[model samples]
Target chain A: MSTLTSHRTRPPAQPETLRARRLPAYAAPAIAVAALALAAAIVYGAGIGGPVLVIVLGALLYLVGLFAAANAVEGRRAARNRTWSALIHSAFVLAVLPLVSVVWTLVSKGAQRLDADFFLTSMNNIGARDPNGGAYHAIIGTLEQVGIAVLITVPLGLLCAIYIVEYGRGKFAFAIRFFVDVMTGIPSIVSGLFVLAFWVLIVSPWFNDGRPSFSGFAAALALAVLMLPTIVRSTEEMLRLVPAPLREGAYALGVPKWKTILRVVLPTALPGIVTGVMLSIARAAGETAPVLLIAGGGAAINFNPFENNQSSLSLYVYQQAGSASKYAPDRAWTAALTLVALVLILTIAAKLLARRNRLSR
Target chain B: MGETPHRSADAGTGGTRVTQSHEWPAGASARVAEAPVSTRSPDGSGLGGGGALPRARAFGAERAFHGLTLAAGTTVLVIIVAIAIFLIAKAIPALRANTASFWTFEGWFPNDNPPTFGIGALAFGTVLTAVLALVMAVPVAMGIALYLSHYAPRRLGNALGFLIDLLAAVPSVVFGLWGRDYLIGPVTDFSGWLNKYFGWIPIFGGDGPYGNSILLGSLVLAIMVLPIITSLTREVFLQTPTANEEAALALGATRWEMLRTAVLPYGRPGIIAAVMLGLGRALGETIALALTLGATYSISFNLLESGGNTIAANIANRFAEANDTGRGALIASGLVLFAITLIVNIIARAIIYRRREFTESAA
Candidate 1:
């Protein structure tokens, strides 16, 4: 009642003059359409070529036209606002064009070879003139290589997260955290180089005769190097998000910290951890450089990752595209599409799972 | 204690607990076997509510788990150091055998008997293309970020943001394929159009062949980097205080003025960080430029000519064919690329770190 009385007793104040007045909302679109039409006509009449020219002229005209029209009707402040708004909107449109174009191009070009034959056979013996071949070997290589990478990375990543979250203290923990971040900034090619120098040049050669050898396991090792930081970062976030009280409760009951984390924490954060792992897998799968450097791209099927060279989808795409054959481009496009599809599927699933976890929690 | 009432219900275990604690020295087991008293029930919420974990817990099991986790954590440091050491060990021989200045020469002939090579052209191309990419991408990314944060409806902004993130996830190799195959024609025409109109400008001065230019490579890189900058700047913009916005609104400031005064200033550091991160990505980008560029090794500023090469692209293009010295020179170049990226990433990290106080408090 008192609050109502206070509100009723308040006096209405005089309004002050403001410099800028907002133009009617429809003014923007009207000006944009008129400017675009004029730009299109002028370009067409002048015999100017390319959609880039048309789009650029149209956008420039729209900004000038909107500012002028608004200035005439309102004032300079409003005109400036109109110009900024137009520019912002045009910037968005420009940024979106390449994304739309890339996807459309991929789908149109890739759909040509996304057939059973594309998946069922290998390019082992396919001639430059021949149109029939598949990424069977490459697909097998990708799966085996990525599987090995995951196997090596996940355990290491989980343990690191467990240490950081459960037992790490002060400088040791901070050093670990800082370096993990630094590790993420290492270029994928550099990781490949590191593996090329260390694994293929030194370690794998030990297993074989003394001569350097490139193999899928070396590629997997490089991928694992790329993947570890990503997994650690994601697992760290998930572990951190596991409520502290759960740990305190477990500790109170004389549950050893490791058992508490294993039985209580990991289960709660598992969905998020899995999502992170999936994303890392997606990133690792798309890498061409690491595989090219160490895996040593091959044409035929090679299931043994520990021994000779193998091919991955990305390596295959690079190889086929570089082959300078007419049909090679088709094979390249299909392999790229397949890699993209797989990565996108994993990414989407991971994102959806993350969203579900957020909502459920 | 709250667990006292439940203790009688589990008296059968209570007898076993006395023997367990007696068998093991109380001090030796740390907090594990010592917690059967009043500690478990002090805070009242025990979801597990089990008879205090048996005497077998802690000690050996705890030490082993911590050791394993610590080892994993330590591996990150080990790997980074190992990479540097190995790169140096491989690159030193090539550096020593160089008959020419390794820093300034334009050509790469490391496979020759005397091994004459330099990273000047490749390094210059790397920085130039990355800078060009940032020039094209940063403004547009900022615009899209502003649109998402300020102009678009909530649902539309979210959908568009998701689409942009999807674009980021598209593999670089895919972008390379698209650029080399599909984007080449349009780029060729655009190059001609620019040269015809802006021929007086040195960058747009090239005549004759126009496709596979630095402009094309940079444009492709711009497209690749767009999402990262957009998403980051959007997050920073969204972090602007609501009170600050409302104050500007109450003062009858226009939307643009409000954003200029409040949001942009607040997001400046974040934007710089985002752009630098994008630059890092563009700098080290390999396959996309490898396929898009004409694979020349010169230091020209021309954006219309069919010529450009980055260190990463060169490595990818020539590594397979490279002899021992050639591979060593490539590793040397890789070291340079690594240093550049490390500097960029560290600076970006420092920028973000400067605002950590505000963020932590706000959270």
Candidate 2:
């Protein structure tokens, strides 16, 4: 490594007078203030037709003046650091600003209509400008559809996790992992198409009836496919963390393998497993594409997922997003807010449950 | 010594030989419980051991339960695989009997009669948008991760990390909503400005009054995926050895140089995995693309033009309206998307596993 040359050896002696030291220290802040003033001036001048030469000349003079002051106050190292910090901070601000703006816009746009009525009523048979309508039916459909998905995914994911973590060892284990990896990456839309084809070709061909076009059950199947991998992967990690001694003790006690897994291993990993399932629920709760394809978008309250078209909150948002009517668009924004709130609630509940389980254990 | 009675029982009978060789745990209670009298009669006649009938019944039940759990696990794996294969089989018609090859054809107008649909445009749109999203997201994500892991004051970093987790939980549809009304409109205006000023550049050329361009879609995707990359990268960055950073700092290097030398190199594998995860999300992204991308079917290299559509977006947009043949074709496109995403995820998992192996071996 190259040896560093100390500034102490080469530099002039430190200023003994208070004025010299204080002046340089004060100069940095002063230059910063002047730089802001010049920027403001340039912006103001640009707002109007400028005397082009004067404006350009003024900007150059201001920059040079500030540069000299900055050099006087701060060493080159500090100046460069500040410049870099500003740049990084600006980029961060840029990233955050859009997100904050979106939230602000949503609140401003959607808050006027968000109320008890919005959550309790449906837009059933409402025309384009029906202001009385809400997303109750869509919310119900979303809950039922995602609820079924949770039911289907949790058991399958848990069982898969059990196998992979507890029983897996050889080629069978490798194959399972490979397939889960594949399923993990399947697009939401593909799952929707899979459900659609399953209903249309495989199930319908035997029944000889019009294909099951729009139902919460169909939406659930699609979402289950989407949610299964997340739940499995997370639960697998949780299961793996369960201490090996517990399994060994159970085995030594003559407990059956399945009994040991169910009683000892599962209890240890239960909190994390529940958290995984809850996260998967939150994930599927807002999925739009599969529901849009399988559960046709409409306005109706159908508690039975086995029959008829079911519109979810997400699909409702989509429907109103593109509608020309102002009410429709406003309703869309409110639905978005509603969806965000529900998801937030679920996330908090999941965390609470996980913490409770951890404390109890 | 306590298992002596059961051990003799296990050794005595040739007819019960299978149980002797079987590797049941030799715990005393278990051996005593499991060592059994052979039934010379199907009736309750051969009682050489105490409570042999009850033990046999209980053991049988336990074995059945074990068998059931294993079967259930394998069944889930089978179901997922079966579903994928079944869908591909159902979508096989598009492969066998399309006018144009699905991979090479440019047009994606599946709704039109005679249905000329190819996935080239969709593929291009999908890969380009995802890659661009990665490019835009990864650096900022890494910076945020490093800041949270190393630079930010402790409480501030924790708070920011919490906020980032909250961002991750925000529904994709909400992001779509945010993108559609809030982001796309301004982005379109920005694109117009780019076209006005930097029109000489090929990338910034093309007139798009509505901001549903590839760039807009990519921006939305980048935003949606930032939290994942950030969280993963933060974990990786935090795992970097403190001594490495201290050594660099001891050499009188600036903070940036310290990070560049110590933190980044150590987290290379993690950053790669994080990028891959982000890529996976980008590949499967539906709602944001659906909302932001102008749902047109033309393929152009120009990002400014609003004609490109991703496979996910196309499947989402047309699946409901598609006829049987059209539905088949859309599913076929989904199969392609699924394959690409699957490969990406597999590679990511492999890298993660390899890293784990390395760390374990080193330890």
For residues B1-363, write the lDDT of model 2, one tens digit per residue: 111122222334334322222233443345445545344444534435432222334345455654555675676577667767977887787656577767788876655666678888898899999999999988788767877887788898878877776678777777887887878766777677668768889888876654788888899899888888888888889888889999999997667677778888888888888898789889988888988898776667677777668999888777767777887888888888878887788888888779877866864
The per-prediction CA RMSD against the true structure, in angstroms, equals 6.3, 7.1
Query: Candidate 1 clash total?
Result: 0
Docking quality tier of candidate 1? Answer: medium
Using lDDT, give the best candidate's number: 1
Q: Which run of 10 residues does model 2 chain A get worst, by summed lDDT?
A: A48-57
Best by TM-score: 1
* DockQ comparisons of all candidates to the true complex: 0.50, 0.35
Query: Clashing pairs in model 2?
Result: none
lDDT per model vs. reference: 0.84, 0.75
Q: Could you give the TM-score of chain B for each candidate, in order?
A: 0.82, 0.82
Residues A1-361 of candidate 1 have per-residue lDDT tens digits of 9997896688634333333455678987887788788888889888876565677788889888888888888888878877898789889988888888999988888899989999989888888889899999999999999999999999999999888877788888888987787777788888899999898887876768788888999999999998999999999999888877776676555455667778888998999999999999999999998898999988888989988889999999999989968999889988999999999999889888988896235
Candidate 2 chain B worst ten-residue window by lDDT: B1-10
